[model samples]
Target: MAEQGAPQRRPSIHDVASHAGVSAATVSKVMQGVATVKPANVQRVFDAVERLGYRMDPLASELRRSKRRIIGAVVPEFESEFFGTVITELERLAEQRGYALVAASSRESEAREKEILARMHDWRVSGVVLAPVRNERSPAAAFMKASGMTGVMIDRVLADNAFDTISADSAAASAEVARALVGNGHRHVLVIGLGEQAATVHARLEGFRAQALALAPDMRIDVILSESDVAPLRASLRDYFGKGERPTAVYSLFLKGTLVALSEFRRRGWHCPNDISLVGFDDAEWMQVTFPAIAAVVQPVRRIATQAMDLLFRRIGGEEGPSRALLEPCKVLMRESVGSPGGGARAGGGDGQ
Candidate 1:
């Protein structure tokens, strides 16, 4: 046959039941360890499952268990400094408040994030803290509609106002960065960004553009947006920078964008702050050690995380009212990499050097 040697797809629960000469419902009961099932039938179900390499999804099993004092947290990823820091603080604070934290990585996949949310629901966690994947109506909304688990959002702001949210004011920070650069004599700027579906990224971009245009009526603020593909990101950056007309400074809206843009600059033998001024929305550890340590508008991760947990606790304690959001202030950490749009740092704006 043309398909010879191709592996057969793994068996499903139905297939396992058919192979064991039992009904799907019976197999499900056996898998759930129902003592009422005949012992022989239980053995047959297990044998069939093992032979077919069939395994139960943890959610299915979790559905049968009693609830726990667990709080679930879902983040896009930790490559960015803010998310990793927020999760660490959330877990630490959760422990102090006598709760357990279960963390999941969405890897920036909306579908995967939804599956994780469903799993959390099935496991009957007392509450959840979410840094939702960006979408018009992300799984966060679906989760709210389909489950009773109380969720408090952090980092990314969801469009829906049906849930409590805690986050540093990303828009304010972006505006501040724009002001700093304009004050340092920069006329034109470029924003390199991804997280196209994310609400927080959108807010930051809006703020930056609004402030840049307002500050200098003649300034040009160029934007480059893409999905989370690294190859396309590199190619796009190369294409933009390869052009004759370049923005005076570059602002990276996402951490991935920041790291990728830095690599591209290095590949082109361009030095930051010397060739182009730079800043990011989030500060990373390596930024502190970079040749011309990069400037960033930094979030207060610990405070945001703690506040999110507080909101979750309030919801869990049956506090009922219209959902609200708490926006904290963010500050620009001016460093060597952000100075004059043309060459070097400002007279006294430099950090360290």
Candidate 2:
């Protein structure tokens, strides 16, 4: 032991290698979890690290590796459960790989999304995971390509093919929802979506429409693109009901829309599956606790997070090939919310004021 006033010498990778009877490079590879490293060497390195209390300096390691040990993640909304779960899982995966994450929410603004990308460039992050906004002309792929930055797109995809993307099979899943609704004997239906700004939403609409029309060409499926805010959604719903005949069932493209629809129905004193049927694209905790459990298509958040990180790291690690689009299947849970269509709005129902 050293004197009280003396500084302690921190054990270095060289010391660990010497104790483990391996080269410094081998120790480094083991610490990095390189599959090429021998199993016995990895065990020895860990044992030596434990015995010597050795800790690698992140800054020095980053400099030596010629890349920052930080990843940037940008999403449309951080408040939503889907994106919140994604960021949490990404942070966990990054920590496991000895990297840090810088997360940002664009709040569904194209300008804000662009600004976040620029900041990621300034920070010289090792890579990015972007869930782009609804703009058709987003320059994310071009910017990343120009800056020699690597990334993976998650949730929503752009038209560009420069980056790998991971998302649920929105079209097929939405089509499945349509099949369920049509099979339940609902001919007239309403589809409430945020807008066509997101490729995910667009895909969902196209899939639902295509499948529904294919099944029953005479079916009346009315669609309305509502603003995501509660008041605007309520207004849109009110206007829809006031304009024409009421739908037997409603399919909301997102969670907020689902909640707003439920609230609107409750305000009118309409019973779910009795007066109107409902389905949503996203699964949420509150959806289950309500009077009637909501039917939803559950996106595999963990799988998406894992796949995005895997793809992003692969790009960062110099993997070269065509950019890939990975789509995971969604699980549809048909709960009590979906049922046979009622005739129309009931007599005692509120005026939806």
Candidate 3:
């Protein structure tokens, strides 16, 4: 019998083994799920564990295994609605798989993105999901090659096919937007984009331009590809609106781009459809709640997140095959913001202040 006023010692594997009347090795084999252990011994070990309240140390067990159940993810930025949703979905999926997920944001810096990849490699993560800042020869690909890191590229895709990639069908979706604008008699169109160097944005620009001109040979399409900074975006939008031949319809290729254009147009007292029709790439919540309810495209972020983690786990599990570049289609939600060009309103021109 234990003495009163004495400290209680935590139950250990040895205690469980003693309670089960088996060797410590047998207890460990049973706990680790080794199939060679006898059925009777397995039952005894479970019963002893329940009685002694002996729980295996997860960290110690991970150390004993060759691969740690840890996944790392790096994105260009966390503030964006798209990336934020992806991260949240990935965390939930990883937890369901009995793995811990670590997330990092690069703030849209190529150097910072590479640094995060290096740190993830150093940590010996089981796998990584990387949304690189640069689409052209991403430094992440080179770093992964040198470090022998296993990962899947998300959002921005590389041309070299160096790794498995998952992204929305940006070109198709952007082309659909152009088709809608041209169908509505919008010959004069404006496209607001960000980071022309990015693969996703570049694809959108080309897709819109190609489709608009193909549908209407004489369409006048003006494109403004600005930096991510709001100052540059606002300056370009103001300059365009202040000049001659105001666009009848505008297609914004990014969420922030859409917001900035809407704000600038409102500040200039220009109303939607009556003055200008608008469409955007991301279907943000406010887009739905606005007075006119802006038309926009909805990216399949949940599917992208799940597929990326699935491919990453396959690689971690030693599956060998040619890397796949999968493109998921986006859904376009057209609201009241898109309409035919106004007859007399189109001719009404001012300083657009």
Better of 1 and 3 by lDDT: 3
Give a tens-digit lDDT track for model 1, residues 1-353: 54989897767889988998999998876654344667688678877876787755655545655655678999988766688788888887565433568999999888888899898888788788888778326866577656766788777774445688877788888888888888888898888888676788788999888898899888888888887766787788889889865677889997778888888778878787878888987888898898888887777888898788767766765678888878888878888887786667766655321
Better of 1 and 2 by lDDT: 2
Where is model 3 more than 4 Å wrong at Cα?
A: 1-57, 158-160, 343-353
- CA deviation > 4 Å runs, candidate 1: 1-66, 350-353
Candidate 3's TM-score reads 0.81
Pick by TM-score: which candidate is best?
Answer: 2
Tens-place lDDT digits, model 2, residues 4-89? 98988999889999999999998877666465667688679878887887777888887787667889999989888999999999
Clashes of each: 0, 1, 0
**CA RMSD per model (angstroms):** 14.2, 6.2, 8.6
Model 1 C-alpha lDDT versus the unseen true structure: 0.77
